[model samples]
Target: MLGDSAYKLALETKRTQAHLPMYNEALVHHLCRETRHIMGELETLLQSLETIRDEPDADTRSVAAQLAVKHATVKRNKRCLLAYQAQRLRFLQNVFWQVGGVPEEIKPQLSPAELDFFSGYALAVNTYKAPFIDLDLTVSDLPPKDLYIEVRVLQDCGEVQLENGSLLLSKNSQHHVKRTDVDHLVSRGLLQHIDG
Candidate 1:
């Protein structure tokens, strides 16, 4: 029962393989409280052990064993918390690179700290790619077979400027545009690619 909260956090992390689950704020808070309580108990045990240091009795051994268990529990809880956060951060980073930015649907599920991290990461990536304005580093490395591709607008994107001209993307409207021109839109989920 002492480490049940940490175990639950581990299980929740394990369940999130492909997509991010909603932030478990309640469980995380509970685990933190549990760790604090255990730490207080550990401190009390330490003082008791010190008081009875010269006695060398069975009670001293019992208190020492309890202190060891409490210390182990604290370590386990800390590890679980760190692992869960690390996994979530890694997933967020992948989403940033794959989607070109964080989607609105995924934003609600992220914690405030995570949202800040995502924003900072996006800014860093944009800054890194600033010099190569003509090239899209986010697109696939393989060469395209065709210069242009067909895409259907899933949402209204207003007017998007291209090298030659601009196109008005309306909901449910289809267009034949250069693949490079709409690759960012496709990654953002505003347009869907169609094989022509």
Candidate 2:
């Protein structure tokens, strides 16, 4: 699903075209495909390790060294995959921000890598300040007022305080809340926005 979304977005981006300097669409596709490939490899490695672990002690001794090597490979690849995803997220964030603005629900859910990339992006754009024209308009703008949103909670969110009252978001529960209050939750992936 993620791979399909990434590819679709890339194709749409290339077809529509960008009027300003932005992240490369084709590169996004490549990174997404690479991440998916690494994830598949990691899954296979983990399953193999599980199989080895389930064997009897006597049988496992012979391949203990091999299992250790495979474990290390899996760890390394997992880190690589995370980094690639972070990079991809950063690019997408910028792309969406530039065109209109990153939806409020996505801003706070940025991973460490994506946050770091955002920091660098912020600094780079800040340096381009204009003396008269004020060319520093890179930051994303805010959404409109009065939005009605429906979200399905992916995990327990404890109690969230709102202006009107507090609500507990239980796992797998669906609720209607204002976008302002739940945007952060959605960005954290704790809640999935369900469009009517």
Candidate 3:
């Protein structure tokens, strides 16, 4: 029997040896070799049997037979392209999913007019721009208790009224800004019209 310390050291050596980078590298090399072997078999089957096509030849028939065999062999693999498609869709859905549910991905390019239209809205939300006034800005996470609710959104060309029920935005505290005033503000390039 070895001494306890020596046995303990030996066990630790074995454990350490198993986890070495060299061991992992070897495993990676082994996997690469296996994959190459499998691909080689597939390549053999897929290689054109008819190096030159002519009127019906034995070579063409041989190639078709080889392909049929390979197809059967490939069926035994862990599914195929459709399986990959399913996995890909799942990944994209996971990334874009939010509490309000799925939103469409924005396209890479928008028309210049659309771009111009959106620039103000983007500036409003992202930065405190002119006419991007937060009339009812609050810290309280409460919905409007009053019967009416109004929100201002900027649009291209001019700003518009976004309201529902009774109340409009508290114009300088007491009343709502008049519809004409809102449109004028929008027309003057001071504000983009809000859409409902």
Candidate 4:
């Protein structure tokens, strides 16, 4: 019962490996409450142990065993909480790298703290990339076979300025552009690459 909430959080984290699940605020609170309760119990046991430290008839071993168990429970709960949060942070970082920013659909599912982290991460990445104006770190790892690729606009993005010239992007319109120019848009789902 003491570690049930933490166990549930661990299971939830494992179940949603492919995508992010909604933040489980209620379960987290419950786990925190459980930890606090255990800590209080632990403190009382400690005081009792201190009082019975020199008493010959007192069963000090039993109190010491209880304290150990409670201490272990507290450590387990802390670990589970940290693991759940760390997993979520890693997932958010991956999503940021994939999309250049958090997608609108995923925004509603993130906690406020996560959203703040995302914003901060985006800023940090941009700062890290500031010097490499010609390179995009968010693009695919595989090297491109061609410099020019045809892309179909998935939505009206208005006019976009490129290295060579400006192009009017309208829904259902196709344009042959440099791969580097549209990689970000493609990742954002505003355009689709056409294979030749």
Ten-residue stretch with the least lDDT total in model 2:
16-25
Residue pairs that clash (backbone atoms under 3 angstroms), model 3: 153-194, 155-193, 158-193, 159-192, 159-193, 160-193, 160-194
- Pick the winner on lDDT between candidates 2 and 4: 4
Worst 10 contiguous positions by lDDT, candidate 1: 53-62
- State each model's C-alpha RMSD to the native: 3.0, 19.2, 19.1, 2.1
lDDT of 2 by residue, 1-196 (tens): 3244444444544443322223344555565565666567657755676787876763555455654654554454445445545456556555544533344555565555555666666555555554535232543246635487889999998999965799999999999897767775665568898978
The estimated TM-scores of all candidates read 0.78, 0.33, 0.23, 0.87
Candidate 3, 1-196: lDDT as tens digits: 2122223333433454222111123333343454445557767755555353544644576667766655554442223223432333343333222111222332232234333434544445345434556442212234424432222433332223444333333233223344433443333333443333
| Per-candidate local distance difference test | 0.91, 0.59, 0.38, 0.91
Per the 3 Å backbone cut-off, how many clashing residue pairs does candidate 4 have? Answer: 0
Looking at candidate 1, what is the lDDT of residue 46?
90
Model 1 residue 55 distance off true place after TM-score fit, in angstroms: 3.7
Clashes of each: 0, 0, 7, 0
Compute the lDDT of residue 140 as modeled in candidate 3. 23
TM-score of candidate 2 relative to the true fold: 0.33
Best by TM-score: 4
1-196 in candidate 1: lDDT tens per residue?
8899999999999999788999999999999999999999999999888888867553677888898999999999999999999999999988876788888989899999999999998899899999987978787667888999999999999999987899999999999999999888887789999986
